[model samples]
Target chain A: MQKIILNQTWKGMLMEVKRSSRTKTAVSVVVPFILLAVMIGYVFGPGSELISFGVVIPEISIEKVEFVDSEIIATVRNTGPIAVDIVMADINDRIYPAAIEPDKHLERFESAIVRIPFEWNEGEPYAVGLTIDDGTRFEKQVDVAAPSIQPTVEMITYFAIIGTYVGIIPVMIGLLWFPFISKLSRSKYKFFLALTVGLLLFLGISAAEEAIEISSENLSDVFNGVLLVATVAIVSFLALNFVGEKLKKRAGASKLAGPIAIALMIAIGIGLHNFGEGLAIGAAIVLGEAALGAFLIVGFALHNTTEGFAIAAPMARTKLMIGRLAAMGMIAGVPAIFGAWVGGFVYSPLAAVIFLAIGAGAIFQVIVTIMRWIQNEEGKLSNSSVLAGIAIGMIIMYITSILV
Target chain B: MLTGGQKMIIVITVVSLGFAGYLVFPAMDITAQEQPEVFVTHSGAVVQTTGDVLDPVYTIQEVEFDPEKYLREFDYGEVSQLEDGTTLREFTIIAEDDKIMEIAPGIFYNVWTFNGQVPGPTIRATEGDLVRIHFTNNGDKEHTIHFHGNHPAEMDGIFEIVGSNGGQFTYEFIAGPVGVHPYHCHVMPVEEHIGHGLYGVFIVDPKDARQQADEMVMMLNGFDTDFDGENNLYAANTIPYYYQHHPIQINTNELIRVYVVNMVGLDPINNFHLHGTLYKYYPTGTDMVPSEFTDMTTFSQSERGILEFEYEYTGRYMFHAHLTEFSEKGWSGVFYAKDNSQPNMEGYAYGS
Candidate 1:
């Protein structure tokens, strides 16, 4: 009876093992089909309803309203994250046909001019409303309708005067320090050269930062704006270096020629920087952010005065004619006038970024040249007086920049 | 008592060993690990991947896109006989730019699409057929459809700018050259338009159809999420790693014809590699004869070709971009070739 019972137990265990193996095989096949079915269901089923609500956020800012002849022209900008489409326009609560220049589509930060042919009485209150594609409306009111001021010769003269005050005069005043600097001892002269390096370094860094910020914020992504800035800066640096090397090679024989070349380079670098600053000021004035007040002019003049000193430091030992000094000052200042005209009339973010990048690159190249010169003069880079002068120079620029 | 050179060698050896240890130990530990724990939601539900759920602020809620459905889908358009007795295929494409989609796991991107989908629709036509596209730009930005084929100068999408917000333009052209081409937005800064998903496959068939086979459209693409002029995600379709997770099913010994179009912008070139088999490549499908029999092919932007092959055995086969960086980022997939004798578990009678 015991043998029979053990035989039955062994048979039962074998059967159980076979059954478990079959189940495992079945599971392996079924699991894949189950997952496939789930995936199909998830893909085609109504459970995955992608109905977006409250996602469309439309915003538009009416920057300016002007009356030209019988037409009411309004400049509008897309201020929201998404692009905005202006479909219809209304003036004084009545729908009117309007023409939008450069199409009705205003991409983010893109501005368009809406022209409406309407004869409006002077000094009358009117509400201008714009309707986007989604029927969201944006309205701006004009208390009194008046003819907009077109840019005139008087305006041109005014901008030129501002440029002179901010760019030319301050730099000329700082250039007067050349006579005093030429009398300094040789050791002090080395310190001033180091100081010039510090000033240029600060300027380069600030210009590069501004370029990056503007490109990232205002420029279109299609332009690869930040990359454009970086590329232009790198190219500018290499190109300036190449040119400087050529100049140095040509001026190899004379000790005086080296200082003149360095001084010219410094002026060019400072000129480019001033041009970018002028662009900012001009754009601000055109955008109605800056008033025709003395604060901005005074601040900019004080800030730009240090650039002249940087130029003069390189040419302190060299005897410069008054005509040459005047020409150098003009080279360091005249680009600002052109920059202001461009910025006020046809300001482009791409141009701003490129100009700033070029300025930064030029300044960086100047710094490198100054450092190499200092090493040549003093035999080593880590002099105590040089370090202190550099610190002081940077601090002075920083303080002046705060006012601007 | 050591010389300077000897001391330097010792220091170098010690630093390298430490560096190697830093890299190798964690990798070894990872290899020893089994299945990862399933991420549980706050409400006690098990999530398959961490990216299954995401914040809805930047991301649109549950974008309706199935890469599998798109793989085999084609838009043949409404066919009609013209006055001259030629075939006319009319299609209407609506462009939109206001949708944010989850391109990868938890990575949301603002994709500008044609007909509400990336890579748009695969437009198919005969070589001599007149294709008329009633293109409408409902998006807030300017867009245009430029076809990469022989056409009249006026028919070119450039020069003639289309305004946005209900702007309409009809592109009428005779499909020619008998090849697979790419149609994309030809607006200024074309890279941005293409990169943001404004491209599609255009297949112009020969007068006589080729051998009957399972045909598919594969548009290799990438996305620049950060807009830094470099693509962060790469894929055969819009979603990254989608094909890898859900392998494409195919029948063994069946001819597979794949029309591969590389629409990735920013990157200069992209490539494809098939594992376990070589394919008969027809460069652009312009000629009747096969150009080469190879397992890999490279393509510049907008370059496309025809890849014809058949699987001999039933198993899973891998296919991916030959460039390792692309494959690692998500431009890889698997083809599951099943034997005909197996049970029809897919529920569909048609072969892939």
Candidate 2:
């Protein structure tokens, strides 16, 4: 009886060991694969629920105007089943919160008005944007004019506004839900890693190209600027990662220490870069270059979409609850909103370079963390599927170029 | 892993396609042409004169060069029809003074002008008026007048085409089939020249309106001579230090017509303001003038108009270029109400 009991115990132990090994293998292979798939979906898949809108006005008028009161008013028409909220309105590089509560339902074609105070001086042009509760947005410009007491009325057609709203739907969806939906039915942590990698790779390559092509009266100076930005971004990213590894080994660091530190650093860098982009946008619209404005908007929107994922990915690593995760997702997108206002109002190319440098540094840091997280258990690193996911993400960017 | 050959092919395809797309999409930016550059006459750009009065550049007012009249007008009860590039009759303008006397030494006037006979003449035609103007550059300096609005490319009257000193060129054009038009000296910066006093008006009537109306024409231009021409000051050998200048003046309700022709070659988009009168049309050529008025109107580019108004009171009313600096310096004039008068004191003047 004693021998049989021992045999049974040994058999049970063997079964338990097998089950544990299987779980470990699954974690290593299947989890990463699923995450990779979600990253790919985010980049290439048709986005969910977000909408876009545009507004065209009499942007250039020599006729002077004297208004009793000047205010920015936006009337939103939600054509989808889901409610679209106005979270904030940005004007002249300043942001003001809108009166949109969470999860507000807006039925099709239902309109709501948002009003804000505005002071427009003659001969100085300005642009205003509305950021919806669902993360979608749109913009319009008030052209510069010489000051006069004469009253003039400018009109914006309803059809044009509606068309713009519809056009932005995909962009909104890509920004708000892609990260969350991508993690569904997979290892959320692994999925975030893949996304971080994708965004970092995209921004890094783009920045490198831009830095190389920097325009300046002195070629060497331009080259120096490019090199300096690259060096700083790369150095900071590596340095932060080294510090994070050291902290992970130390006692008493919080569970969130590594990712939190890395994310905040990256956010700082990206915020700086995005500010310059905002300035460029502002200057273009102010100068009455609508076409250039549109081009910048599209490019920045794409770049911003990737950044939204970058901020969310690190926070997600802590296995935060879903509601908390959604909040973090939005927090990451806040800089973009601020950046847009800045670009639309305070535009200077030199400022653009400085901000871009900061973003490059932050991105470098975040990407290094991502690389370390994905490294093999062995000292040597290898992840074919995640790399494949990157290729797929690039394809998505390619497809959007054609469609957009 | 994928074969090297396959990878090479994939890379080539992706790169080639991207290059193709880059080439294709930028074609959407369609506007890629060079705009004409502005040319100003350099050597004779300024006049050195010392005087108590501020020296000023010359100016032409819209009322004096009304460019917004239609080349042909429809009958009052008839609907206006649209027409383009139809050759019309020929006409001319002569620039002579009113008195026909050598009023003052070295000052000649009262000469028989071409169209109505004043500083220059008014030339009238329809939309596509292939009108030829024969001009005698009998002024102190080599001069040429280019019909500004509504003309064929060959008759653009660019400075390069303006003839050399003592030379002349015949300008031809289809009356601008659409809006008010502009005419000026295609030579050097004509602002100083016109400011020194040299210009006139040309009115192109739409074929549909009455051939002619009870019209009283006036020219609004500015000049700066050392002596006060307003008081007709006389100087023996030297030009007067500071005397009188024309502050372009006009009255309302008299069917007072204007065909402002600017000889100013430099200043673009002079603030053309009309006090107590709102222009009926604002256009490029005298082809599509709006029929009525509401308030102040603006003129842009090389444009002209035929505006009408009536003054409410009698006084030495002032009409000057609205370009504040230009007008204050000397580029303006004044008009007297037949019944309204101001005291012309010994050496004093009224109004800015």
TM-score of chain B of 2: 0.46
**Model 2: per-residue Cα lDDT over A314-401, one tens digit each:** 5554554555444443444445444444434333333344445556666666666656655632232345556655565556555654
Model 1 lDDT tens row, A319-377: 86667777788889877777777666556666788889999998888888888878887
lDDT of 2 by residue, B1-352 (tens): 8887658757965874565343222112222223321111112232221111111112111212111122122112111233663454444433222323221212233322223222344444555455666554434344556665655666665553433333556665555453334444544555443433344455556667632333533333322222223212111001111122233233333444444433332345443455554545434334444555733333343345555556666544444446554443333334444432444332223322
Where is model 2 chain A poorest over a 10-residue stretch in terms of lDDT? Answer: A56-65
User: TM per model?
Assistant: 0.41, 0.33
Candidate 1, residue A26: how far the Cα is off, in Å:
73
The alpha-carbon lDDT assigned to residue A294 of candidate 1 equals 49
lDDT of residue A124 for candidate 1: 86
lDDT of 1 by residue, B203-300 (tens): 99999999999999999999876565766668898776566656788898999999999998888999999988899999999998999999999999
The candidate that achieves the highest lDDT relative to the unseen native structure: 1
Write out the backbone clash pairs for model 1.
Answer: none
